[model samples]
Target: MAISFYKYQGTGNDFVMVDNRKLAFPASDESFIKRLCDRRIGIGADGLILLQDHADYDFEMVYFNADGRLGSMCGNGARCTVRFARALGVIEDVACFLAADGEHQASVERDLIQLKMNEVKGVEQIGEDYFLNTGSPHYIRFVDDVENLDVYEEGRAIRYNDRFKAEGTNVNFVQRLSDSEVFVRTYERGVEDETLSCGTGVTAAALVAGMLGMQSPIKVKTLGGNLEVAFEQVDEGFKSIYLIGPAKQVFTGSVSL
Candidate 1:
């Protein structure tokens, strides 16, 4: 069977999105999905997402990492999924969708998307590093010399360490350029390497700094481009956090898998 797909990108983290509301796609096919995400062999993307019908929410977002493993919520994927939902008439201008983590509120404006991430209770400090879950797991650590650090090697080591050996985690090396402005570099798990940008990783990094008392409305600069993270911390935890930026549609075409 042939499946129709669309291509979308949030920053440089790209994805292949499919409309599965008909439930015709075989989401359980690991090798099939993996082959679709292969850059050299098939349709190139950092991951794949399926938009399915939901009972309560606007739609359901089923995500798979590049490795073809069913993964947790992806911020960028969620954003693009919102756009796909809109294009498919699954949602209106604004709507809520269910992800692996939970329900999320989203909106679309042209190519830009604003996605509401998961609630963060607080940031756990381990020495100078911080850990938090922004939909997906991320380890945010600040380094004095961001320019000199070998991000791929260092992040790979941390990701594969015993702390997260079984299922590796994404690692973000952050450098505070200012109280509200920061630079972020992330080593993503599914990609198994450095990505131009990671929405959840940067969100965790900035919010971890905020929980550490940086400031609200943190500006994070990633290798791909600049993004802004805004939120308010309540007694229960940090709520009303919005991951705002452009989720560009790089290009679209057909490819065999």
Candidate 2:
């Protein structure tokens, strides 16, 4: 069988997207997904996204890590998936879809996607760092120099630490450029490496920065590009959180399976 796929990227977090409305692709094929995500052998992407029909939403977003594991809600993947849904005519300027985390809303203005993310109840301060879940579990640590830090080595150490040994957590190293701006780098668990950008990771970083007295409309600079995170502080925690960034389609092709 030949499956047609689209490539999409949001701040360099690329994904191989599939229009699975007909349920053509067998999502249970883990090995096949892993092989397809292999950089040298098949279509290289940080992850794979399947846009499927939903009962009460524009579509259902099914995401998988490069290692072929079902992953949590990916902020970047959700943004890219919205763009993919639009390209397929499943949606127009606005979208309401169900993701692994929960239901989400988004609006597209050209290449920029503003996705409503999950609300954060609270953040656990572990020593000098903070841990939280913004659609995905993340450990955020501030750094002095984000550009020169060894993200892979340091992130791997914390990711595999005994505290998060059972279910690993994505790690984010953040450096503040200003009161309202920051530079961030992430080591995603599923990809198991340092990626150019991570939506949820940066969102967590921005929210943490805000909790620490940073202003709203936090500007986050990732290796791939720039993203903006805005939120409203509520009595319990935070609400009306949005992750805004660019999601661009790279190409389209068919691969034999």
lDDT top scorer: 2
Clashes of each: 0, 0
Cα-based lDDT for every prediction: 0.86, 0.95
- What is the C-alpha lDDT profile of model 1 across 70-96, one tens digit per residue? 988888788888888887888878989
Error of 2 at 240 (Å): 0.4
Question: TM-score for every candidate vs. truth?
Answer: 0.94, 0.99
Residue clash pairs of candidate 1? none
lDDT of 2 at 240: 94
Runs of candidate 2 with Cα error greater than 4 angstroms are none
Worst 10 residues of 2 by lDDT: 232-241
Predicted candidate 2 versus true structure: per-residue lDDT over 207-242, tens digit per residue = 999999998999999999999999997767789999
